[model samples]
Target: MKRVQDWLLRFRWQKLLLVWGVFLLIAAVLFAERSGVQYTHTRFRLSYLPQEQAISKAQALQEQPATCLLLCDTRQSGVDNARELFTQLLQDMKVAADVVDLAEVSVNDLPAPENYQTAVVLMPNVEPLGEELLRLMNWVEDGGGLLFGMSPSNDRYFTVVSAKLGVLSTSGEYKQAESIVPAEGFMLGGGQRYELSDPFDSSLAVALREDTEVYAATGDEKVPLIWGRRQGRGRIVVDNIGIYDKVMRGFYAASYSLLQDAVAYPVINSAVFYLDDFPSPVPGGDGTYIRRDYGLSISDFYSQVWWPDLTQLAERYGIHYTGVMIENYEDDTLSAPERQTDTEQFRYFGGLLLRQGGEIGYHGYNHQPLCLPDTDYGDAYAYNQWPNADAITAAMDELIAFQKAVLPYAVGSVYVPPSNILSAAGREILGTRVPGIRTIASTYFEDGSGLPYVQEFDVAPDGIVEQPRIVSGGMVGDSYMRLAAVSELNMHYVSTHFMHPDDLLDEDRGAAEGWEVYKGGLVDYLNWLEKAAPHLRKQTGTECSGAVERFAALTVTTTGTNDAWELTLGNFHDEAWLLFRANDGVPGTVTGGQLTLLTGNLYLLKAEQPTVQILRQEG
Candidate 1:
């Protein structure tokens, strides 16, 4: 027994030593990896996409060569380094772009011949005079694009710029050379090796820290990373930190391309100037045609109007009708059972509609605008106005709860504001606060932008939604209702609405001739849509909003080292069926619907109808 005990003790010591030795080995390996001890230079792998792809994409929309003036107030080595980097990037773009160092350019020659499209002012530690800066602001607002880079220490300068540009500045110092991912249709190059680290100390990683208040006119309170506000006819892009440092250090691998894209986005978006009625032969797929379904909103049982003729007509026309049930309405108040009756009626009517392939969306808690005060005739203006965030939030909570109660399983991700009076702040609060609530409609009606007429506005930058507008009243005469049908067709989803048949009948009885024209226009539009449905890619409103959000989260950039280039792809599409065409014009197969790289020159092909191929030669 004594001898066995001795051996066991000996074994335990040996095991401890072995375990410690293994731990040490792992730590050593980790340290070596972190230190890049065993790292070696690798050959760069270029994509197979032909250079022609670039030319093709640029051919039709060729941008004129623009000169950029870089104004530097600092004589530091960092500024010199940044200038060199800018020079190199300009060469890489292969365009006739020039960057003039302001220090070298005589100040007496302040205004270059109006040909210089952009002026980048770099203020390291000094703040320019407010009046001089105002003049520069005026220049940019008039037409010239301006880029401003500031350091954390230059708070006064930052404040001046932010005040003028309607942006916020972070107080904390930024790390040099941070890698930023692009959002959409942008690509990044250079393998991990070429990835940017803090330029000050190549060993340190680049990072942008935010701990500052965003400055906007007192009433406009939205936080934006990069805010573009129309200053006169042109625009200004404001960066809180020293962009020159990032660009020079390779932190911004695709800064050059991104700058170009930024300048072009507004232009392209503006080119779509006119709003026309929805297009025919809708851009994408097909579906069956059923009679228009009117959503009869019933706040309570007593308010329910059961017209046998209407039900019969629905059946005859094979209409898959939907209905919204709110808790209460302006005139009719119901008892508990009556309210329950509303839900029960909805279930029965909903099931009937479902049998005919219809759907249902939530209305509101009391058949009124969620946050607006209640009035006698469902008029928001007459009700107590919603003036703050608390009221809006409470109203939203009530609406959501009511929705969950009435149709627990039947409800999908859709909400129709009672009068489209929802505020931008209210919508943002709801979207950010609620889960599973996908889409919300708003009241803005002007088609100032030629986009779809959907009432919702994306409070968050990059958010988008389908705007549903009332098109017609009846199916009899020449009231041609038009929408941006082609744009909506390309979208993954759509949302539209109609009231009850009684509402239509009332309108018709009051003004038969006008109603007839409205109805005829409605019928014509529906028929046209049905014929064109085959090309439309239909998705629910929730799906569409989610898609836009996901696309917004993506990062796109380009980076290149001496030997090779690498492009880092971001979540541009929730599920994009990407098409890659080789230099030879042959479509190559994509893996899991994603194309990582083209061994030779390759052009990216556009997809239509989720499956159809639309090819364009590379720029």
Candidate 2:
């Protein structure tokens, strides 16, 4: 790196020339492709859908028997998990309903009575005015359910809303640690703090009404965190604990799940397990433990020390892991002898993984940014802020070539960008240059100057799907538990988590300590998932990506209202659920899979095939 840096310093113009040269090459490729009438950039999101009609966003949000109305000042806030996820959770659970907010809605332009199944008044900055309250009351009286929530403040409208629900609110922070037990039917988990909320407690309290049923209770007293009652023509549920937890800082406590129950949204519980940075890069030294240690190669550790233990767990738990394979870094190619050893040992090890039901994914050719190297991993984002597309394509080409020769057979479509950062230009280059890679394994929140945040996931704007690995575990059991909780928000939602194999070996002490952490921490996590969420669907990165891609390419819509609808799916899995917000209170059924409750306003149809139907039961 020093030699290369010095060379670049001495010949600075070469960098400019290199960029220009790559640009020219890209132009030439584009021109040739244009002549043949096969332009790549135009193929962007178009290629993902070989045959399909788009479901208009307007149609999906049209009037329905069920509805979720979140009242908040949109201009005053950013992304709140409660506000954003509440709707997404509904979508995943498939309860057919429309979610309306002030930004795209006006109280004057509210949906018809047939659409008002549930009215959720979220934590607004201020108590709703008299006129708004009157409207909400009338909606409830007209049969609209209400998930009434307000942020922490003893001096706020607690008195007014509590009076309306016939409950009582008090001012006391939730400092005590305790388990919450929800009533038998609530799908929102009755679990521990979602890791993000510990150390600090919530500041909200509520005393239940005598006529109300408690859904979730907190502390030794089992005080109501959420409680509901039937009033006039509708039901109203309130969880002061939830409003405090979410409004304060998105702490995602069980209070949040309890709130979902309060809203009565049907939920699909799920979990996903996978590995990251599997084929670790050999950091710059030949005599290192990774290259050859104590007369054994790193591959020997993976196969003998690593594989045996993980394989036993996989077999025991029926889990399939996707190993993110890293090829090179900053021109850090292996010596001829080392490459030969790697080729042979990897073939054997990868074959073993494949036979044991594991798969491999591309992490990157070089574990550093594609733009350039600075002897520092942190500097990658700066260099790749706007990396050259053609150079990235060249690197991707080399990676595919190497994978063909070295890794085992399942050359899947998942790619985990190095440092978890890939410029949008770099991402699109992967889609255009390597059409075989249908998905990119990346952080839930992509950070790049090139890709817009909206197009980062849910099948990125580039036509490639992004199967997000929600959380990271570095050999910690409790951490894994927290991450697992974070991943299992809804059953129909994709669950994904990753761990580094190097976590198996202590950095300073090497394999001895890491393997212990891996066994004790991660294995416990798998078991916990089995016990906590037994129905978790296990799949390789390839499979997960394919599921997401198919779903993204699909267009599910409705019109003829016999409580039935038709959908045109893409390359979906053997069993998958397509969720939608429903109008009626009663649950429905389906043929391909099953009709399950997601939320009060949502329903999920699980099935297999490019076409499926959902028939709402007649009252």
Candidate 3:
């Protein structure tokens, strides 16, 4: 009996040993796949097809009835701003405009006022136009739309047309407007007041008639910022918000739509959410917050706690992330680029992101900013500049190779500058050597001088697309929301936001509020965005760059009749998106495009061909 019991015990011990062996083998296999040191390279390539203009200049400017006249005075101080506003905002709307400089054309021999549906005056002091200004005003009284691009000047000429402008009286003093409060439905995501950080005397101190409809006003005292009134058979829309910049383009764009019966403009129609320094080395941050809440280390908290929550949030909101990889947290600028071998974290996170319809782009070989040695980072950033261009090239080359080895199927087209500080030399190197880098995502708004490289949504002269992020961070504020709303109306823009994984570690970035509170703030903004603009397309960073490329390459000309509107696109791509506003007609049917109703009378049109025609019943 003792011998039989010993045999059974020995058999049970062997069985347990076999089980442990199997577990060890499985762990080894997983470690091999997740670690870069044991990588098995594959031949999957991701490419970026840069868009180019497909139509000639003559074909672009097709014969169309001029719907608007953009009048500017070269002698005026704000003329350049007016022209830029017209070019960047109004021209892209497909509204055919006859731009005439007052300095070039004699006031006596001005173009006929009967040829236009609306006239935009850019001159601050219209006294120089003599009696010619009256011709434009008479046209307005006779069923023509008129828009004053700037606030009314206290000159005698403007006082003569005070009644036409809906002004009952003027204090002849500029009123400081610290906040902009748009009425509900005046613009997308309206009703929230935006307080200006740098308030100035921007709005004119004027009272309006009872019939005048105020669209926006100053907070607190409720002074009118923008208002419109009916004059005779036509209408007059006054843009009293005197601010002019890329940030203010949307306000003016929305105000311009008030003049036309129906208007349409091309749009990118994509919203991209970028993750900077994601899937990199565990950031250096205090784990006190993590321990207090989840009882986990900073590394464990990121993987076990933070990631699950963030991933759930993205899934809930249908947000696909575009994570820019930072190979290492080392600030190495002088040494040769080194490959990261312990890439288990990157493999785990990056795989999940890609599987969930996300993308992986380049952040940097290290945390150092991509500036030359001489570049001054100022006090805004503490990043070290690269020693030389060769060092940058070597680092970037290694990063590209490493990403290709790890993520062979993912596209490396989008590149976000580390710390938003890329010097001119760094930019040149990127444009020339880094052919795979098709887009540079930078900041859209400047916080301070020498802080960040501000960019616009346009193709650079170097053929690389510049798609700047409008707002960032998890703690979304009213100013950021307001900016997002304005840009949407003006450019048919979708928001580009960026966030870091280590935000919870930094006290200034709401770490003390804890993950629950910080995440709640982010969720609130996402909910607001979903409710406000549900039709915005959620795309990865590269996809957004492609959309911007198409928008920048295309030129459109619009022609309108009593019952139909036709748009001819110049650089027709495979697909294009546009926003069409129908004020006096119900859009019936569309050819070469499909229409989706957005809000109020606004419709989103997706065009697949060069020509798009909308048939509508005349209202």
Residue 234 in candidate 1 has what lDDT?
Answer: 48
Task: Go through the candidates in order and give the C-alpha RMSD of each one to the true structure.
Answer: 26.6, 15.4, 4.9
lDDT, residue 368, model 1: 38
lDDT of 2 by residue, 1-619 (tens): 9998888779959779788999999998755432322211111111233313222222332443354455544543432545665555444333344555655666667655445455556554334333576667677776666765533345455565666675654655453324344444443333443333352344255565578766555545565656667667666666545433321221222223232222222222334466665554533323244343445565466656666777887888887777776664444423221222344434554555565566777776666444422223354333332234555666666666676666525565677766566554566567678876777777654344443222222555445666666555634355434544433443334456777665434454234444555467666666655654454467777666545544543334332245665554433434445544443334455545565564344444565665666565677
Give the CA lDDT, 0 to 100, for residue 560 in model 1. Answer: 29
Please give each candidate's TM-score: 0.38, 0.69, 0.87
What ranking of all candidate models by lDDT puts the best one first? 3, 2, 1
**Most TM-score-accurate candidate:** 3
* Residue 406, candidate 1: C-alpha displacement in angstroms: 4.1
lDDT of 3: 0.78
C-alpha lDDT values of all predictions: 0.36, 0.51, 0.78
lDDT of 1: 0.36
Candidate 2 weakest ten by summed lDDT: 38-47
lDDT of 3 by residue, 1-103 (tens): 9998788687857788778999999999776545533423221222234444422222343554677888878788777887777666765565668888889
**lDDT, candidate 3, at 22:** 99
